[model samples]
Target: MRQNPARRNALLDAAIEVLADEGSRGLTLRAVDQRAGVPTGTTSNYFSNRADLLEQLMRRVRERLTPDPAALAETLRATPSRDLVKTLMHQLVDRTRRERSSHLALLELRLEATRRPELDPTLTRFFTSDLDANVAFHLEAGLPGDRGSVLLLYLGMLGLIVDDLTVPEVLRPHGVDALVDSLVDRVFPPADHHGEEVVGQG
Candidate 1:
């Protein structure tokens, strides 16, 4: 049982690894402590119970899984708007590929959230806030899409990432980059030459 933030984060990372490999059924406090290579009952020192551990795990995963706004800003600043969308989508694909275990654990938490009604409020707030921030980001960047369109793009990316990560063959043939390009073209509709309206053939 350590009060250190580093130790706490280490435990959470261990929990993610457990969840990714063994699913929620195997995410016991003892299991987490063992996975973290800490003393027995150490998880209980930080997390009061299973629910608390899960809630904190969700928060931690959200923090790690989301895109980096500052980096995205720098990227968008250097690239054309149409290309920025592709770049961001490619980032999503890259993250899913590189962080497969974390993403899988995130999916496990999502399923657990469905069973634990008490988690809804916290999860809801997290998702709502994230969506609002994303919408604001797109608008601030002068992207050619309203919040609804932005949201669609978000969902599309999520679905693509999940499918590609879980079942790579489905997307490997066309390539994630090409699929993302098509998706961005469909949802974003690149700006016209005259800067009046979107003008891209789907």
Candidate 2:
């Protein structure tokens, strides 16, 4: 039988809803099937087991959280790094909103990864890749060696996102800009930031 693309995505989407609305403990192939309106076996068909489902969901969430590399690089090449950070921060917030379900899925993944050492490698790899890449992006913004600091702030923002503590409007309007500036100041320092090569290949 040919797999249905729409149905497959529906199952995953339903799975996302299950994670977001019901938490990880509530995520099951049956639950996803119920939410997606597909047969119970449909979700299982796409995923082999519970771990497979969560892993796939985590992948989807990371994909959702990630920025467009080609575009970001091009923009970075043309724009000042200082300005880029705020834009990137704002964009992340928007992406989070767009993939709210995935966001919750990621949280569940994190919790699971924390509890299970085996999953830690995958989970850490996913989030660290984002942090490492963004830290590289920050360096492109002319902030040198600020990866650790940026990771912290980035994580802080993520926490706000997870807890629904932030209002995107305020974040972009003033909060994001201020955050960018403050992070740059503390992490880069004026003296350290003049003409340094952005970390990584940026």
Candidate 3:
């Protein structure tokens, strides 16, 4: 019910932290209030209930993870190629690492969604729209891939992120950057002289 955008955003940010640190079960108005350093009942004033808080947190996480428009525009100016896709993937990995808390909170929200059927539709919509947008972007940019390539890239990067965040040790030997490069190379392999994709080529 509160109309103060800044305060509401602060509360949502705090909720993200709480979700990351304590999981969904520990998310409560009092916990958010303490995390945000606000007075008791402050969060309740902003969020109607636990479900409302979770929904808002999901939106906030998306906002926090969005790519920088200026940087994206700069990248788009370069010729579209596998290198360009690698650059974008690197940026995504870097952003995910930098916004560790938000990403972790996102994982928590996804897990919570499994138990709360009411959340399925919202999460599904968000993921589906994001995938569609990504596919459209790749096609428009003339990237070296189709919808299937984009989907594979998405799944590969998602797995990389999960492993990088949850268990870096597993990938430390291969290195995150190397793994990303490998993922991009495999998903968007170089084309042959005839402009046909060469799959499984060394």
Candidate 4:
């Protein structure tokens, strides 16, 4: 029903706002329609049911949350592997800070998926795509990280984002930058070619 991409994105944006404000239990077709300020039945016309709405919402989040190619290319060109890890962390913190609502909605989806076995495939695919893309990025940038390293870094960043958004005071005084630097140091530590300690040295 979204003959226009703008309208579709607007509705998805509305859904994210609803998820952030009202939680997953409050997300309904009617709620999305109302949140979008559209006529009744609008969301149902676009999305057949809650599952459909959630699937589209997941897709939209992926599209919106991915790193910008041009910006990433420049950063990769100018930064070393260790500094690049810090840059990635900065990007995560900045995006989470700026897009708190959307990120919150994503967290809701993760929890909701845990209770819905049918959604496991979609969730798995979504995360696998992220991991695969991350691996590709690391390879292209000559970053020090294997798939396992990506997994660990991703989990750490996800936890940091969740904490930053929910209980921000928990990370007070030290701040996100300091935490990120620590993570970068630990995740992509310095290594010599002959030294067998680093993850990506194969």
Give the number of the best model, judged by TM-score. Answer: 3
lDDT of each: 0.84, 0.69, 0.91, 0.83
Which pairs of residues have clashing backbones in candidate 3?
none
For each candidate, how many residue pairs have backbone atoms clashing (under 3 Å)? Answer: 0, 1, 0, 0
Worst 10 residues of 3 by lDDT: 122-131
Report the lDDT tens digits of candidate 2 across residue range 1-202.
6777767767777888898888778988899989988766888888889878776776666665677888767766755544465566566667777777777677777776777888888777877777787777677667434567677667666655764532455455555546645654454344336755443221
Give lDDT tens digits, candidate 4, residues 1-202: 2367787788899999999999999999899999999999888777778888888998888877877889877877765567877887898799778888888898888888898889888888987887788778777777777777777788888888888899989998778889988887777667768875664432
Please, what is the TM-score per model? 0.88, 0.72, 0.96, 0.89
Estimate candidate 1's alpha-carbon lDDT, on a 0 to 1 scale: 0.84
User: What's the distance in Å from true for residue 191, model 1?
Assistant: 4.3
The TM-score ranking, best first, is 3, 4, 1, 2
TM-score quality measure for candidate 4 = 0.89
| Candidate 1 lDDT by residue in tens digits, 1-202 | 3399999999998998999999878999999999999999889999999888877887788777777779876878764476777887788788778778888987886787798878778777767887898889788878667888899899998899989878889988998889899998888786678865564576
Q: Candidate 4: where is the Cα deviation over 4 Å?
A: 192-202
**Number of clashing residue pairs, candidate 1:** 0
The digit string of per-residue lDDT tens for model 3 on 1-202 reads 4379999999999999999999989999999999999999999999999988987888898899989899899999999999999999999999999999999998887898899989889888878877898889889999888899899999999999999999999999999998889899999888889988899875
Candidate 3 overall Cα lDDT vs. reference?
0.91
RMSD after CA superposition, every candidate? 2.4, 5.5, 1.2, 3.1
